[model samples]
Target: MRLIIISGLSGSGKSVALNTLEDTGFDCIDNLPVDLLGAFGRHITELGEDAANQRYAVGIDARNQPEALARFPSILDGLRELGIHCEIVFLDADDQTLLTRFSETRRRHPLSDRDTSLSEAIQRERLLLEPLHERADLTVDTTRTTVHQLRDLVRERMVRAPFELSLSFESFGYKHGLPPDADFVFDARCLPNPHWEPELRQLTGRDEPVQAYLDQQPAIAEYFEQVRTFLANWIPSFQRENRSYLTVAIGCTGGQHRSVYLAERLGEHFRAERGPISIRHRELV
Candidate 1:
C-alpha cells in the first residue's frame, strides 16, 4: 500500500486536497486519528496485498493537540517496516493569505479560539512544524490559487511517478487579464485585432471565417507559424527533462476572438505531435 500522509498547518487546504486525491482514485481517510495508521496498513495487506489497490491518503495536522506530533514519526516508521511506500505532502500559505481567507469567510482560526490572535497562532504553528515540513515530498503554497488551479496542481502529483506530463492551453483577454498559472504566455494582441472587422466581430479564431481572415493577414500567419515552430522545438526538451505539466496562454483584446482561435490551433498542434495536452479557453468558458 502506498500511504500518503497529508499534514500541514491548520488552514493549508488539506481537507480539500485530500478530497481531490480521493476523486482521482486514492482511498482517502480524513483525520484518521493518526494513531491507527499502522493497523490500517497491516490489515489491508493481510486481506490480500493485491486485492484492493492499497493506496490511501491520511490527513493529520495542527488541529490535533500537540501530542500527535510526537507520534507522527513512529507511525511512519511502522508503515515503512511493513513495506508500505509512505510519503508526506505538506500544504502551506503565506500568513497574509491565511488571514485574508479566514476573515473573508467569517470563520475563526482553528487555534484562535484560545484568545490568541490568528497571526500569533500562525507564527507559532509554523515554527512548530518546521521539521515535518522539511521532510515533505511536496509542499504547495496556496497564497494566490483559484480552486481549479489548486486542484490541477494537486491532481498532477496524484498521478503515479513516471507519469506523462501534459500540456495545457488557455486563452485570455488583455482587459479581463492573463491566466496566472500559465507557464508560457503569448501576447497575440500585437498580431491583429479581429474585433475591428464587422463581419468577423461574432467569430472567434476557432471559426473558419475568422481563421481565414487572419490567414489573409501576413503578420498573423507569420506569427502563428513561428509560434508553432518554437513549441515543437522546446516541447521535447521539456519531455526529456521530465516536466509533469506545461501551460501556454494566448491573449488578445478580448478572449472571445483571436486568442480563442489561437489557443484552439495550438491545442491541435500539441495533440498532433506532443504526447498529451488539455486545452481550455479560460475566458470563453
Candidate 2:
C-alpha cells in the first residue's frame, strides 16, 4: 500500500500537507499515536499483495508535547521490516513565521499552554522533533506561502488525487462585521438597500423573485456589473495562485435582501465564467 506520513515540527504545515494525500483518495488518519503506527501498517498489509492500491496518509504533530512520539525513525524501521513502503513528508517554516501565526490568531501553541510561555515551549518541542525532520523525503517551506498556495503544492505532488476543489460563496450582514477567515471580502451595502421596500422584507436573495426585485434598483444593477468585473479578474488569479478555495462575502442590512441577491448573482456569474462555485448565505440564508 502507498503509505504517506505527514510530519513536521509543531506549527509547521503538517495539517495542510495532508490535503494533497486526502485529495488523492488516500485513507487519511490524522494525529495518530506513535505506538499505533506499526499496527496501522500491519492492518493495511493484511489486504495482501494487492494492498498497494490501499493507501494511507497519517498526520503526527507535537500535541501533548509528544516527547515519546519522536520514535518515528524506529517506527519507519519497523514498517520497513513489514515489506511496506512509505514517504515522509515534512513541513516547516521559520520560528519567526510560526511565532507570527501564534500572535495573529491569539492562539496558544500546542507545545505549551497557559502554564508555559510560547517561546520556551516552541523551543522545547523543536529540540524534540529535530531528528525526524532531517530524514524527511520532502520538505516544504511555508513561511512565504499562503494557505491556498500550500494546498496547491499538495495537489501538484499528489498525481492520482481527485478533483476536490469546492467553491463556497457566502453572503453575510456587515453590520455585525466581516467573517474572520474571508478569502475575499466585498462591500455590497454600498448598493441600494432593498430593505426599504416593505414588499421584499421576508424574501431572500437566492429566490428569483428577490433577484428580480433587486435588479429593478438601477444603482444595485450598476454595482453588480462593476463587482462582476472585479470578480472575473480575481477568480482566475486566485486559481493561478493555487488556491484550494475562495470565499467571497457580500453584505447588506438584515442580509435578506440586497446581500442575498448579490451573492446569488455572484455565484451564478462565477459558475458561468469560472470554475464550479459553491455558495453560502451566511445571514440571509
> Which candidate should be chosen as best, given lDDT against the real structure?
1
> TM-scores for all candidates?
0.58, 0.53
lDDT of 2 by residue, 1-285 (tens): 667778776666777777666776778989888778899988888888667667778987676245556677788888968877676667777788888888988877876877888888778876776656666655555665678766765665443322223355667777766654356677777776756767766677766777787778888879889888887777677656534445577778667778778788878887786556666565631
Model 2 ranges off by over 4 Å: 64-67, 160-285
**Model 1 pairs whose backbones collide:** 205-261, 206-261
Q: In candidate 1, how many Å is residue 271 off?
A: 1.0
What lDDT does candidate 2 reach at residue 67? 51
Question: What is the per-residue lDDT of model 1 for residues 55-125, given as tens digits with 9 covering 90 to 100?
Answer: 67888776665676667777778877887767777888778888888888888766776779999989878
How many backbone clashes does every candidate have?
2, 2
Superposed on all Cα atoms, the candidates' RMSDs to the truth, in angstroms, are 6.2, 10.8
